[model samples]
Target: VSGVRDKMNMLGAVTDDGERFIALTPNQFNAEVAKHFLRAVQHEFGERLVIILDNASYFIAKTLKKQAAADGLLLEYLPSHSPELNPLESCWRQLRDGRANRLFLTLDDVNEYLSTALPALNSPQIYEYLC
Candidate 1:
């Protein structure tokens, strides 16, 4: 690998019909990355989409909301501590659990793992994780 880094963030979302979107951020997740990811989602789903989010600091940023509003998308926050209400939460939990006892030698390793993991999650069966 060309370089080593401590953190990588995954910005992910799922639609009501179980479409999954994953954006790999170079570093820690922040409002900027959040906004960029939202823009891509906007491009995919177009206007009037309501994105359900957890209260991560970046997701709640005023700038992100303004951008979403301008794009005709609405951002709604799930109640605190309510991961179950977020459909993507289950996929994230699976990702976490799958890697809980492992270490990746490179970012490519992480990417490979994500590639392998996504197919199982891209279907409507993702509700199993929510339950």
Candidate 2:
């Protein structure tokens, strides 16, 4: 027997003031992909940004550090083993549990669900996690 499998990676952030963003990728997380997400956040905020993050290697990569510096962004890593301190973790949990116990026929179907479901995650209620 065989089972179909697909992989999706997301880079997400929530500002202390309630702005939130998400980028979906087919490839694994790395400095290059991280640079893209940082650029997007910079584009949206158009000001110096401070992002609290977990200790993912790519998040601390020299290349990504240079990109953030050039873009006037700050990357702050959370304490080890402290996922609860990162607001984005709550966002992911919400997204995952939002679709639990459901099935999709294709990756596109899943993307479609996310396209709609993700915005729902922007509600003022969820923004509380950032505070």
Candidate 3:
């Protein structure tokens, strides 16, 4: 990943209703970025949302939890080692497949690739039943 220093990192979520939202950022992924992305998700979906999360440390950060709680959003954690239970897991796989062994010359090149790849991923068939 360091090979592409200017490459973007995405923080994304997929709803049970099959809507996808993404935020592009640089390398660092911490509490602040997670909280900010959560807020964006909340704003787009509404504060009554319940977000399902994996046990990533930043996703479970105290401040992020507090903010979500205060905002009337529920944070639900999946059991550890349960990537199969996360709908985003499949989407991530396809995303990785799209970029497999490719080298982008610049951040713009990456974004251009994403511009096409993401919309192709928008179909409902990409998600699995998480129950």
Candidate 4:
């Protein structure tokens, strides 16, 4: 081990049909991250995106809503305490399963693994999580 350990905050989203989008951040989820995610999705899939999120405080921020509206995006909040309604949660579970028992010397190592691992979710076998 290099004796270097770091905590990386990440925001991720999955499409209803199994595509994955993720971002690594130095801090917790906030309006900035939320806006970045919105813009990233819009840039990837074009305008008029509808993103569904859990009851995370940042997702409920008025500033975020305003910014999303300005970006021609829509934000939908899932029912409280009902994680099963969000298909992205299953995608995260699969990510956790894939990373289980792995050891990383640096955050980049984890990020690299995730970069490869995430796309695997597009495969027929792993794609079930989004269905």
Candidate 5:
């Protein structure tokens, strides 16, 4: 649940490999958002890789297809209403329900909290859960 409020954009990425990263950007749901997620994929798995994504308008199947074509990636789509199949969904739930919800304040405050939470989530123990 990446969201923009008060000109601040909060975006999070959690890979099946359990390498989670989040960013604070001024542009919400823009090319930078897509690029950030794609960059994480490349960093973890290189250029040629397959990634499953939920059906979000910003990261829609068509948009992913176009981005994949441009980047030479293989983006896969999971069925709607089946978020359990996406490991990132669990990560998002953790962040939103467990972390983000508990510490909701100004946008800047949320971004600050996310900064600390994201890197901490990229541990081997957390990665195992994704597997």
Candidate 6:
């Protein structure tokens, strides 16, 4: 999951069976990320599928609705202020506790650590913890 500390922006996504694939972007919450996420899903899953998102910004909601309408994708938005409803929040907590909390001398080091850590998060065994 991605959340800007100064803004009420959080982004998260998971597979139909609850596999986490999330990121914390430096960019602000916007339609662009939603569009990119759709593309990423297409790239990864091939078949267009319904996506779920939490309502954070109007821009994201508008952009997601537009893309879903245009691309024949289904989009569902969870009720607001309910972080626990999103399993990816647990994953984010794990990442923050495990990797992001550790100090690094450089952005590259942070990137490298996240690059190594994210894939390990995808393991089915970890999903149990999130649940």
Query: Which digits, one per residue and each the tens of the lDDT, describe model 3 over residues 19-104?
Result: 89988888588999999999999998876988888888989999999988998989999999888877777778888999999998
Q: Give Cα-based local distance difference scores for all models.
A: 0.80, 0.80, 0.84, 0.76, 0.63, 0.64
Error of 2 at 110 (Å): 0.6
Candidates in order, TM-scores: namely: 0.82, 0.86, 0.88, 0.81, 0.65, 0.72
Each prediction's total of clashing residue pairs, residues at least 3 apart in sequence or on different chains, is: 0, 0, 0, 0, 0, 0
What candidate 5 gets wrong by more than 4 Å, as runs, is 1-12, 30-32, 61-64, 100-105, 122-131
Model 3 RMSD vs true structure: 2.6
Ten contiguous residues with the weakest lDDT in model 1: 121-130
For model 2, state the Cα shift of residue 125 in Å: 7.5
**Per-residue accuracy of model 5 over 7-55 as CA lDDT, tens digit each:** 5555555554456555557775855477666766677667777665666
Candidate 1 lands at a TM-score of 0.82
Error of 1 at 31 (Å): 1.0
Candidate 5 total steric clashes: 0
Model 6 misplaced regions, further than 4 Å: 1-12, 23-26, 58-60, 122-131
- For model 4, how does the per-residue alpha-carbon lDDT over 41-97 read when each residue is reduced to its tens digit? 888777878887888888888988999888888888888998777676666788789
Sorted on lDDT, best first, the list reads: 3, 2, 1, 4, 6, 5
lDDT for position 20 in model 5:
59
Pairwise lDDT winner, candidates 2 and 4: 2
- Candidate 6 residues 42-61, lDDT tens each? 66665667666677674257
- The Cα error of candidate 6 at residue 55, in Å, is 0.6
lDDT (Cα, tens digit) per residue for candidate 1, span 65-86? 9988888887778899887777
> Model 2, stretches more than 4 Å misplaced?
1-4, 122-131
Candidate that would win on lDDT? 3
Candidate 2 has a TM-score of 0.86
Q: Which segments of candidate 4 are over 4 A away from where they belong?
A: 1-5, 122-131
